[model samples]
Target chain A: MSAMNKQILLKSRPNGEPTAANFDLVETPVPTPGAGQFLVKVIYMSLDPYMRGRMGAEKSYAATADLGAPMVGGGVGVVEESNNDQFKVGDYVMCGTGWQSYCLSDGTGVMKLDPKQAPISTGVGVLGMPGLTAYYGLLEIGKPKAGETVVVAAASGAVGSVVGQIAKIKGCRAVGIAGSPDKCAFVVEELGFDVCLNYKDADFPEQLAKACPDGIDVYFENVGGKVFEAVLPLFNDDARMPLCGLISQYNMTELPKGTNMLPALMRAMLTHRILIQGFIISYHFNHLPAFLKDVSGWIKSGQLKYREDIVEGIENAPEAFMGLLKGKNFGKLLVRVADDPTRN
Target chain B: MSAMNKQILLKSRPNGEPTAANFDLVETPVPTPGAGQFLVKVIYMSLDPYMRGRMGAEKSYAATADLGAPMVGGGVGVVEESNNDQFKVGDYVMCGTGWQSYCLSDGTGVMKLDPKQAPISTGVGVLGMPGLTAYYGLLEIGKPKAGETVVVAAASGAVGSVVGQIAKIKGCRAVGIAGSPDKCAFVVEELGFDVCLNYKDADFPEQLAKACPDGIDVYFENVGGKVFEAVLPLFNDDARMPLCGLISQYNMTELPKGTNMLPALMRAMLTHRILIQGFIISYHFNHLPAFLKDVSGWIKSGQLKYREDIVEGIENAPEAFMGLLKGKNFGKLLVRVADDPTRN
Candidate 1:
């Protein structure tokens, strides 16, 4: 076991797009396992858009990660030492231990991972927070019935990919909105979505309308900007929207300029009796067991699939994460912080 | 009875503010009741801002009144003749009988009025749709627990008045928003609202913030536009919004100019886990019996109060209705189409 650990800390709040200067990498002593605590050597770190919200001082669903603190994130790790009865040395687990080589946990939020069933890295992606987010948001709020059209933005990414696939499994037509043709193809051809539209296309709205002939019954709102504008007119009566995230406007310093269509939005809601709800997965933590059960079964039966874009080194994590904001990553973005002992 | 009858018909679709030229008064032979049908002499016609939506060709909850068709509206009337076993002559009932001196009904959607309990005009105002709207909207969607702050726009109008009173009954601090100082005064002094702020006040937002120190938990959205803009910033985490109507923007021919704040609205909903639902009373008609029992008890116990603006004569119904859209009526606007036979 290494005596030294490399940690990334938040230096200052970013005004708009985050820079490498905003994060400080420092060598520190590896944390010791306390009573009922386990020391983990992180193998894979999840880089999600939600972390952007944590970086800002603005109020969000999750509390802002304080400056000068190790930037908070979800990661899969191998237990190096254990004082906890539930975990033992070399047991693979998923936990929010931030951007660090080693971390300490007391088995509170940490969950055991089965490398035999699926890749250990998936414990932070497909069978984890992003996957759970899509499952609950779509099933609980979106409530897409059979034959209904379900639309999701950022469709090639972690949450959106799962949302699209789940919609398909529920017997609904899944429409994906991605930034490029490659991402669109990945969503449609790889993830089994019925259709995928490039949001950057000049005729994106027209394409969306054509794709959703029955109109959109459920809109899994992950990216809110131009994609939202395109989806707005296609929303049918009694449309249900589960607002999971808004990656498009996360870096926005000022309110975007556009047609003030709030009245229209309100009218659509009132006339059509639409239900639009926003949620965070933490609020529905009690349903985690059920989520894992259903998701695991689907993955095992080949009814659901997931993709991962793994960056090899922790030093490249900030750049990969930044690229994720710009819709560059084609799948769930993760950093390989250390070699996987379970795989070896 | 005279064979001749006066009826108001849709003449033309208005551009913005409806004019008298948009409505036409026609003389027609009164139609006789058929088997299982009854004749009604409309005594009081309800004037509501929602009627504006019906005048346009645009799709809404209610179907648009076609040109040359008799203008549709809710009214309380005495059954002048009956072939239906359910109704008898001289029985006061509430029905959607259009703007006319007489109407023929096949007994569907007509409710018998208890003249001994309250004024017959209340069948078209506080104790009827508006009252039931406030009752169900607040209790079901708003779900204001004891001590929660509930804010309502158009506070002295039919629905808003009942909403504030109901919130007060539920041990909540009821804050009212009206257009005029006099209306605001009536809401606070007469209706017993904790605070009343005029929407016309230059410092209205500040006043609303000051009035709701704990923040608004339930916002009954009836009058949209600037009132909604003001309430947006003060909405607390997990706030419930029952969108009943958007009267302020009903007359809009063009989209309003401002920052597209829907992303912010979505972000707010996400950050707060707020539930915003739009509903119509017809959707929850089965709950009416329970609502009537609860609301009637509140009114009789002096815990609920209502106001009515009664305009005399059916000929003035058009002007009275026009005033409703302008927020000119101080209370529930009702046109006394005929003499209250029971009162006489």
Candidate 2:
């Protein structure tokens, strides 16, 4: 009755733009469930930009993932063995299972999923962290008002898509900046964004400025560097910037060479009276109930749409993650570790 | 009897730091009070850093001073003759009189000053714009808490001095940054700041870091550039910055040669979740009554102290103003256009 578990471990710390060499695929014994615990056979693993931050030793909102240990992440799984009364065998659950085919978890911080409600894999994507992140980061920090311009980067991805849709719902002009033409198309056409600029375009900055004629009111800052430089001069007085992530600069080994930008940025912030606040989504979980209620209704009513780029098998997690970092993946990126019984 | 009225006119806009050549002292016949108007003999001309912004044709919180016109500023004056019932001859008042020895007002924005209160010149400095600037910028925006560290630049000048004293009153450690050892001494010894660092010192950044043991919670940004660079790294999470002015960059012809500082500043703003906002004091005039009551009480109770650096005679204004920009003047820089009867 014994089975081997497939796991992806952090083989080495990345210098810049993490490659497959930084991760190792290893076989380990299936974890046994003790009292008040359960063994999960992970079905889906979420691949996110923040994982890059966790791989580094630098202090971030989340602690660094230890080397040669299972790379930290959240996953949706089926409870195969359980001693806890709250989670039974065959129960669908979402927990911090890292990048593994099977993981041991206590009932703490794990949420049970209902099969009839929606697709269970969504427990890690639009219905979970990314969704909540877009919700609070935009509504709470950006405070987008009717007719205001709301700009978000990584437009076709999980959080950015939701942010643009929500901005539309709030009566704002949702402008998106994505890495490719396809991503831009998906954002503007499918996600109902007013305009989506391709950051890869040589005229991206000019196009961005032309798109935001009244100037940007609420900027959801996910990508930093060039995208930010374009957005800076176009900021209207009293613009609010919700700085959720700096994905563009995550792989930068050293600061880019230039005149120090800190003074000019301060001058802009002062002149425009911009409110730039960086935040971790987990800290503001109190907005979860409201987010779920509103977003669920939107999805059910066809007002909100989501796309998933799911890769098959646990062994491909590292490659998929690298793709995710390079803006190669479209929509909410995930690794399908095992069969989702609820899906089919 | 005919008296010639002297006025300082803007000769031409300077490319960088303004020179005496930019100002022209011209004489014109003084006008008599018309219907509903009063004649003011300007006594104290307040020279502030924000005047630098008005000289340029760029859009700001206030309108640009017209070329070939008298330079715009606030002044404390005596109502020499009045046709308006609200004002009378020999009464001291404060109004936006520009840089002139005589001005005619309709009593629209003029405020009657009681000689019995503080000195009438303070109507432009401590009890006026600078006082209000410090009060609102610190209390409303910075929101310094007990035991928190508050840092302000231009420590011995009008606004910074008040900001430091107010931070002290709120039970926070007040650190001042100034250009010279003498200015630093006045800030620490006379204004009761906990410590004052001279930005002119070679080890200024190190000294500033050492001074802020708990890291900076509140930074009152009056002099931007190197002082801001020193403060940026020392900011704690959730630090609040009230960016009231950037006196250092006011005279710069172009941005200093170096790495573009905007990205780095944005990162700091995001990482620290800092709230940096620029404001002009006149916009927040709703706080005037409360400001007057509290500040006057502090001055009377010895909880606050004020020092005036008055340049005698109208002819010395342009040179005095240039000195004011270079951190040459101590305390609030005021040009005495006429005898202050209240002072004697």
Candidate 3:
């Protein structure tokens, strides 16, 4: 048990888009687990758009990550040592372990995972936080009725992919909005969206309008800049918008200028009786059992599919996270932090 | 059947705020009611914020007022002659007659009003459309739980007054936002709001922040320019916004350009799991009978109070409507088109 723990700590808050200089890589001694606690050697870490808010000083639902502290993130790992009754030394667990090689947990927020049932890394990706996010956000907030139109931005990403697939399962016409033709093709062909339109296209708005003839009934909002601008006019009467994330504007220092469309947005809402709601998965954990039962069944039946973009080393986490903001990742963004002895 | 009929028609569409040039008064001989139709002499015409949207060519929940036709409105009138079996000459009824001195009804959308139970004018005001708007908007959209702080703008007006009273009935702390000290005092003292603040005051935002220490759980939005700006930061997590109207910004030809706050609004919705829904009363008409029963009971029990700003003549309707937009009316704005023979 002489292994040293390497972690990434925030050196300072980013002015706008974060840079490597804003983060510091440091090595420290692995922490010991106290009574009723377990120690985990990190295997895979989940990178999400919500982490951007944690980097800012603004008051949000979740607390901002403190300056000079290890940046917090969800991770899937194996217990190296255990003093807890519910876990053993070899048990795989999912916990919030920050960007680090190892973490010590007291079994509060951590959940045990069975690697044999699904891919072990998926405990931090599709079968975990991001999957649950898409599940609750769509079912509870979006509530897409059969034969209705459901739209998702960043459609090839982890959450959006799950959202579009779930909408398809519910007999909806799933329309995906992505950044590139490849992502659009992936969303339509691989992910089973009824239509996929690249946001980068010069005629994206017109294309989206043509794609949704009946107008959008439910919009699973993830990327929220120009994509949202394009989608606004196409929203139908009584449209439901589940505001899950805003990856497009995460790095913005000042609010976007040039288009004051708030009044138009308000007018649309008033005229059409639209409902727009915002949610985080943690706050809606009460719906987890139903989510797991429904999503797991969908996966086993091959009705819902997911993909992962795995970066091989813990040191590459910072770069992978930065690339995520630019929509460079094709699927659930994960970092393979350590060797899985059980897999071999 | 030889009575002369006076009617107001739409002469032109308004550019921003409407003026006298937009309306034309025409006189014609009153025609006899056809089979299954009844004739009524218009008594009271209700002037509401929703009428403004109808004036514009833009699509709203209701059809836009057609050019060179009678300006659409809701009115309470006494049956002067009857060809329909459902109504007699002496019966009082409420109908969508627009701005006119007489009307013919097929008794489809019109409701029979009992002058014995309450004033017939209540059919168009507190015990009617405005009352239903308050009940459904607060209960259905706002969902004000007991002990939560509920805020309503345009506090002494028809819809806001009912909203504040209903919040009190639901055991929530009711805060009212108005334009003047008189209206503020009326909202607090007469309407039974827990606290009332004048939106015109320089320290209005600060005072609002101080008044709602628990933060705003529900905002019954009617005035949406500066009042919404002030209410934004005060909103608590999971706040419910029943966006009933946006009277303050209704006259703007273009969106206000100084600060674009849509992203911030979207962020607040996402981070806090807030629900913002826009609604018109007609959409919730199915719940009207139940709402009427409950609201009528509250009014009878003295648990709910209402006010009306009645102008004496039909010609003054335009001036009164303009004043209603400027917040000059103390309560529900109604124009007395003809004398109530039942009251005499």
List the global CA lDDT of all models: 0.89, 0.89, 0.89
lDDT of 2 by residue, A200-287 (tens): 8899999999999999999998888888888888999889888888888788777666666565666777667777777888778889
Pairs that collide in candidate 3 are B73-B98
Best model per TM-score: 3
Error of 3 at B156 (Å): 0.6
Q: Write the per-residue lDDT of candidate 3 for residues A1-344, one digit (tens) a residue.
A: 78899999988888889898878899899999999988999998889888988888888779999998889889999999999989999899999999999999999888888877777877877789899999999998898999999999888998999999999999999999988889889999998999999888899999999999999999999878789889999889899999888887789888877657777788888888899988888987788789878888888899989999999988888898989988898899999898866666
- Which window of ten consecutive residues has the lowest lDDT sum in model 3 chain B? B255-264
lDDT of 3 by residue, B1-344 (tens): 66678888888888899898988888888868999998989999999988888888977778999999988999999888899989999889999988998999989889989988889999999878988999999999898899999999999999999999999999999999998899999898888899899998899899999999989999999888888889988889999999989998778888877667788787778788889999988877998889889998998999999998899888788778878878889989999999977676
lDDT for B322 (candidate 3)? 76
Query: Listing candidates in order, what is each one's chain A TM-score?
Result: 0.97, 0.98, 0.98
* Chain B TM, every candidate: 0.98, 0.98, 0.98
Task: Return the lDDT, model 3, position B172.
Answer: 96
lDDT of 1 by residue, B205-316 (tens): 9999999999989999998888998898888988999998999888889986769877778788878888888888878888889987888888899888888898998788
Docking quality band of candidate 2, CAPRI definitions: medium
Alpha-carbon shift of residue B242 in model 2 (angstroms): 1.7
lDDT by residue (B53-92, candidate 2, tens digit) is: 7887766657888889999999999999999999989989
Query: Which residue pairs does candidate 1 place in steric collision?
Result: none
**Candidates sorted by TM-score, descending order?**
3, 1, 2
